[model samples]
Target: MSCFENIAVEDIQSCINAEVPSGISEVNMNYAVHADIATFPVPLAIGAVGYTYAKANVIEEDIAFTAGKGFGKIKVQVNTGELTFDGVGSVGNMKQKSSLSFFIPSNDAQLLGFIRTRLNTPMVFAVPERQGQNRLLGDKFNPAYISEVKGTTGKTGEDDKGVQFTVSSFAIPLIYNGVIQEPAIIP
Candidate 1:
């Protein structure tokens, strides 16, 4: 049995554009898998036995926008999973830990550029709710909110690929309420 047996394509599409702001000529969203820490060692060892394993499961949705004059934003959300580890031997054992984190900072210009460039094009994005609905959708789904442009690429020391944008604003549809709300700084 499939979980999406009664979902309408239009309804799903509607959810996609539910957060687009007014005056924005166009909007788009792309989904991608940002796998981090594919396998990490668990801190569990005994006697002469040792074990290590790490796994990261995350589904990211990248929302792109083009409100004229190159002014746009990319909002990404991550659904994370726990880390698993196991080790059993005559003289050894193993352990591991996992966490889910998705928060983008507000001063990463390079990361913003990278996302805008990669997600701006047309590509097949995965729909987490309905895995069978994996299809190519242009960057035009408006979200109910544009949380923050965060980075999950992890820390790279001096390399610092861990830059992200903390999006605290979003554009919702007028049908849900009255007039559209103007952009206000989130404190």
Candidate 2:
């Protein structure tokens, strides 16, 4: 029997009359060690929504945070934040590589030093979009790591000066349907 024969088939088209917006409005980041998140949703192969991956649309449970621990919020500027996915190999050995990139408008020494410590830390991020469902970028099984951090203080006064971070993972982003909580920070 052919491998295709065992796969479920269904319509995978989107709504033609619906409108979709663009851009991420906010990012909620937290250390993976301080939280527990559910795995990505998987399609039920033998169910009626098998081909459509209905259950993969949204996660219903919230991420469990350690006592007194919560996500750190970052407000993204227009056109400054985005998520990209690249397939690393062909179908037989394919892997989904997802990356989240965002710019921080500040380049303070203290903040720079704090971010520097995250080089080896695994993290999970929640990206809230302008007009769509919130997206969760990493989980316990497939955590995200800060691959790059670039801090710049531009020469010209009009030029942008800030830090850009690139977070990478081996999983696809999923719709998050839980409340995002952030702890108060003492200044």
Candidate 3:
């Protein structure tokens, strides 16, 4: 019943050598302010079988969100979106810090309004990775927040002009196993 007990060592001998695609193709953004359910995620119980660090840190159950309370899908540009994890393994705090970065091409009044609302809102981001894996950042306990938003109108016609968003959270991200249901954008 000890949390520090040694579990079976995982073996990587059967791993295959193959090229895997990188970078996020899309991000599902969920605002905590608009969520009907509480933001805190259900924590996994200790002593559960096959409870690894990756599984123990995140909720393994599917999240059911009502209409208009579900995630909003954002398509990321090629090579424009990525999530990074940084953590300290000290005894005092073993928490991990994760950051999600992506660019939204083009800027309009409607987009500005949406960006305004994100500045002060708590959020959760689900990013799709290779091999049909969905990675979730920001649980209920550690909701993500917009750390920075940089917009630029390029001087040259060929230069990129858009807004880049950096969403960050102090909680370790999870490998999502459930489907991400998108809410109706117009409803």
Candidate 4:
């Protein structure tokens, strides 16, 4: 008696209601060729996010050191200061060294060429995270820089995103204007 028995009205309603599902809207980067740190980042190829993909790897290492001069009172001291291993921390092992690396897709030729040309220059990257209801939830933008471009490559493997890339966002800064991944934000 039913022509479309598999179709449900609630499923249809749910799909229609789920507008802001938190998808990768856009990811773009710009570089300054042999430019000073004070210089603003110029768009590499303007607004182009064709087949865009981006990733960042953040590494945080623990800090540890020894603080004490000589083995004992009789040992005496040759150096003025205590023998200590230089590490990141004010007091004890309470600091971590953090660094970031990104894997970006070479979607546009002009942008890829810019990256190749300025492979050794300081660059600023602006990445925007937008959703359908970003207007209500307050979208966030992640900005970072690479002091020196360490590696460059182009490869195609059996399993790759059109081409080879590398990076994973870990210990990366995420300044949330409001709670993002929540039931209400996406709903």
The whole-model lDDT of each prediction reads 0.27, 0.69, 0.71, 0.26
* Cα lDDT tens digits for candidate 2, 54-170: 564456677766555566766554578888878897888898788999888888876777687667777778887768677777754677888889888988999888888898888
Q: Show model 1 residue runs off by greater than 4 Å.
A: 1-110, 114-130, 134-142, 151-160, 163-187
Worst window of 10 by summed lDDT in candidate 2: 34-43
Worst 10 residues of 1 by lDDT: 169-178
Query: Across residues 75-98, which tens digit of lDDT does each residue of candidate 1 receive?
Result: 333332111122323443432211
Error of 2 at 76 (Å): 2.7
List, residue by residue over 1-187, the lDDT tens digit for candidate 4.
Answer: 5543433333223455675634322332222112222222122122233211121121122111122211101111112111011235577445323233333333356545544654443322222234421111100122223333322343545422212221111123322222112111210
> How many clashes show up in model 2?
0
* Candidate 2 backbone collisions, by pair: none
The all-Cα superposition gives candidate 2 an RMSD in Å to the true structure of 3.5
User: Considering lDDT, where higher is better, how would the candidates rank from best to worst?
Assistant: 3, 2, 1, 4
**What TM-score do all the candidates reach, one by one?**
0.19, 0.80, 0.81, 0.28
Clashes of each: 23, 0, 2, 1
After best superposition, candidate 4 residue 133: deviation in angstroms?
12
Report lDDT (Cα) of residue 18, candidate 3.
Answer: 73
TM match of model 2 to true structure: 0.80
**Which RMSD values do the candidates have, in order?**
20.2, 3.5, 3.1, 24.8
Cα-based lDDT at residue 62, candidate 4: 14
Q: Which runs of model 2 end up more than 4 angstroms from their true locations?
A: 1-7, 27-52, 184-187
Best by lDDT: 3
